[model samples]
Structure formats: C-alpha cells, structure tokens
Target: MQPVLRQLPAGALLFHRNAPAYGIFRLVTGRVRLERVTPDGTTVPVHTVRPGELFAEASLFSSCYHCDARVVHDAELHFYPRTALVARFRGDPNALFDFAAGLARRVQGLRTRLEVRQVRAAAERLLLFLRLQVDAGRFYRPEGTWKDVAEEIGLTHEALYRALAKLEATGRIERLRGAVRVLRTRPG
Candidate 1:
C-alpha cells in the first residue's frame, strides 16, 4: 500500500495523547518532538525524530498514542497505516523481522537514556547525553535549545545550564550561539 504523504507547518500537533493510533510516521524531512503532559501540566519530552526515521511505532499495536507528537520544523512525512502494515507483515516474515528489529533498537536507545538519567550527578548526565547526541550526529547543530535537551535527558533547564557552564569552563566543550561543540582532549 502506498504511504500517505503529509506536510505540516512548524508547531503543529500531529496527534495528542490518548488519540486513536491510526498509523506510524516516517519523517522524510524536518524534525518532530514527542512529548507527554503530566497531570500537573508539566511537559515531558519523550524523543525527537529526525529525517529518515520512523516514529510512533509503539502505537502500531496499541489502541492509542502514548504521547503527543508535534512538528518542531516545517515537515514532510509519510504515514504508514498500522492495519495495512500489519496485514503485510503477516504475509512477509522478512518484513516482520525487520520491523521488530527497528522496535528493538528503539527500546535499547530508551534503556540507555534511562541509565544516563539515573546518574546522580547532573554534570555526568549532561556529559553522557551530549556524548550520545554527538555519536548520533545530533549534537553540533542541535534541533532545539539546551532546554529541550534538558527535557529529553530528564534534567531541569537550570541544571543543564550549570552543567554546560562547568563543561565550558573546563574546555571540554565550546558553546557557540546555538550549538555546543565538544572539544577533543590532547594526549599527554
């Protein structure tokens, strides 16, 4: 089945929490942020989907979306209907296996993020998160501000600022206008 194409302007809410799960989305261009709002009205960021990545996969089997997905930039996306994809997977073992593998990778990423957030030291958490982002090529030209990163890493924005300041003072990273560049250490 042909995936349906969608174009959304920045700040558009693709779906809200508890909404029925119609399909999963593949980001062809631009960025998307998945977030959940707490009962106290706090917004907790879940993940940021970049180009070429599929998001909301968990919604495929679920009745509803676990979080709200919003466009962070003007975006072009392809919506793959869950029902159609499941039907195809039933007839194709290779397709089912590949889809499972992608879901496994996403689970592993979330596990690693959980471990990083468990670190008691805010600086350590920031450093680890930054390293992970750098490894993913998402650090240098970050899609959102440090505040958004703080939410993703489960830290307060003030704490993130403090950690960045410490890292900057130690010359571990260079802070540009809207980016953070990790500096390479010289071997003695």
Candidate 2:
C-alpha cells in the first residue's frame, strides 16, 4: 500500500486541469468526483468515486492530468510522486499487469458511456447503465445527478421516464425518482 501524505476535506479539487503531476491516488477514505466540462464551460458530473478506488493513476504513465478530480467527501489519500510510481511500475511485471487491467477497465467504461450515448432505445441504454452502476456498487443520486443520466444515456428526459416505466413493468429494475435499484443482477 502507498503512504498517505495528507487528508483533504470535502469539496476540495485535488487537481485542476493544469495542476502538477501527483502520481496515482489510492483512495482510503471518502469520495471523489470526476467531472467533464463542456465547450461552453459547463461542468457536468460524470463519475463519483468511493473508498478503495484509484483515480488519476493513468496520469502516472503520461505525466499529465486528463480530467479534474474533486473531493466529494473528506478523504485520506496517498500522494505518490510521479517519478517513484513510474519507476516501481516499470520494475514489477505483476504490477504492470494490474496497471494494464485497470487501464482496460477505464477504457471499457468510456466505451460503455459512448455506447449508451449511441443506443437507439432509451430503455435499453438506461437498463445497461443501471446494471453497470449496480455492478460497481455505486448509487447515482448522492452524486447529485439523474439529469446527467438522461443526458449521458442519450435520451430526452421524457424518454428516460418512459423507459423507466417500461423497465418497471417488466420487473427488470425499480426506479426511484433520484435512483435506480437493480431487482436482479444481470449476467456479466
């Protein structure tokens, strides 16, 4: 395990777009928000991180920040220096596999998001996103987004509502106003 150098309180933006390369973050406590900004400078909440999750480690390989990381709740995190992490990652073959696996997951996650955006039926895309979230054990409401659900799932709000009704009718999932709860885990 990496050493924790500091504890940042809630609402802290760990790294702004041009911030220094701080290696990988090993989250030991609380949550982090990964936000995507639009061309008009509108900040959209894309993902919420929880304890035992790693973020920004991809930056270790490239020595650059890709997205803004903000703390959603108070958190204790390791602030590994980029040089050290890179050296260790290169030296250990096993570690390299783990790193590669992680990067693959990140890539797959992005691909899923894009697929959700391109899907023709709102119900199908919404069903897929909920299954992915449930698989990750993440609940979306606390992150302050359900609207982003409609937007990112590439559905009009009315379409998302209609899809929810459809899913509920089939007993595939249950929809609360701010959240979706899985009735059964879909096979991977």
Candidate 3:
C-alpha cells in the first residue's frame, strides 16, 4: 500500500476530537501531541508521538477520533489507510501479531501512567516517573525543562517545583540549566 505523506507546521491541528478517523499515522519527524480538550478549553495531554512511533491506531476500528492530534513541532508523517491495513492484518498472521504487540505496549504505557497518578505523594510520583524514564533509556542526564517533565508526569508545575526543591534539599537530585539529574532515590 502506498502511504500518504503529510507535512504540518508547528501548532497545526492534524485531527480534532470527534473528527473522522482517516487512518493511522507514523511520525516521520518532529513531534505531535495527542490531547483531549474539555468543554471549557482545558487540555489534558494523552500522549506525545515521537519519530518512528504510530498514533491513531485505535481509529482503525473506530469511526472518529477520541482525542485531538496537533503538531508540536514542524513534522512529517505517513498515513496508512485504515481499511487496507486491516485487510493486510487479516491476510497475514505475523503482521497481526506484531500489531498486537505494539498495541499491548501502548496499553502497558497507559497502565503505568495510571499507576503513577495513583501515587499519593508528589515526590513518589516524580521519582517513579524518573525511574521509568531511566529504565526506558529516555532519560539522559535530563535535557527537558522541569515544566515539560511535570506535564509529562501528570503533575502540576507548582507541585513539581515543590517536589524538586524537596528532592534537591534531600540530595536526591541536582538541577541544572534545562535539565535535572537524579542522584539517588529512596522510598519516602
């Protein structure tokens, strides 16, 4: 199947909530943010799609998008037709297995996020998120801003700041310009 390429500028809306589910997309370059916006304009980020990852897979069976997808940076993507891909999966068991594995991983990620949200203490939640990042090979001496980190970890900016301050005071983390380094962590 020939994939359609789309180039979007930063901040462009690729798909909005309740919009038609055209196809699944693979981010070829740059970043995309998938979020659910409340009626009053509050945005709750669901996931961030990076290069080589697929998004909108749930749309394969659904008629409409459950959330909005917006380009966070200038991005290029390839869209695979939903029906054709579904047909291919039906024809190839190995392809279906691989697709199921990918979906499972996405589900596991959501489960972990849910667990993080359940942690009562802000510090523990932050630590758990950092440890998870480290385990995923996504943490490298922390190049992301604290605000971005907070958002990704589902913490309010103020709460994250307070947690960071406490962690720093306890010698658990060291903050640097545009980055945070985890020194050590212990159960609180």
Q: Rate the local accuracy (lDDT) of all candidates.
A: 0.87, 0.76, 0.85
lDDT of 1 by residue, 101-126 (tens): 98899889889989898888888788
Tens-place lDDT per residue, model 2, 81-136, is 78877777788979878879988997897798887777677887888877767753
Extract clashing residue pairs from model 1. none
Please identify which of the two predictions, 2 or 3, would achieve the higher TM-score against the true structure: 3
Ranking by TM-score: 3, 1, 2
| CA RMSD of all predictions | 5.9, 7.0, 5.0
Give each model a TM-score: 0.59, 0.57, 0.65
Score residue 106 of candidate 2 by CA lDDT.
Answer: 78
Off by over 4 Å in 3: 9-20, 28-53, 63-75, 134-140, 143-147, 156-162, 173-188
Q: Highest lDDT among the candidates is held by which one?
A: 1
Question: Model 2 — TM-score against the truth?
Answer: 0.57
Determine the backbone clash count of candidate 2.
0
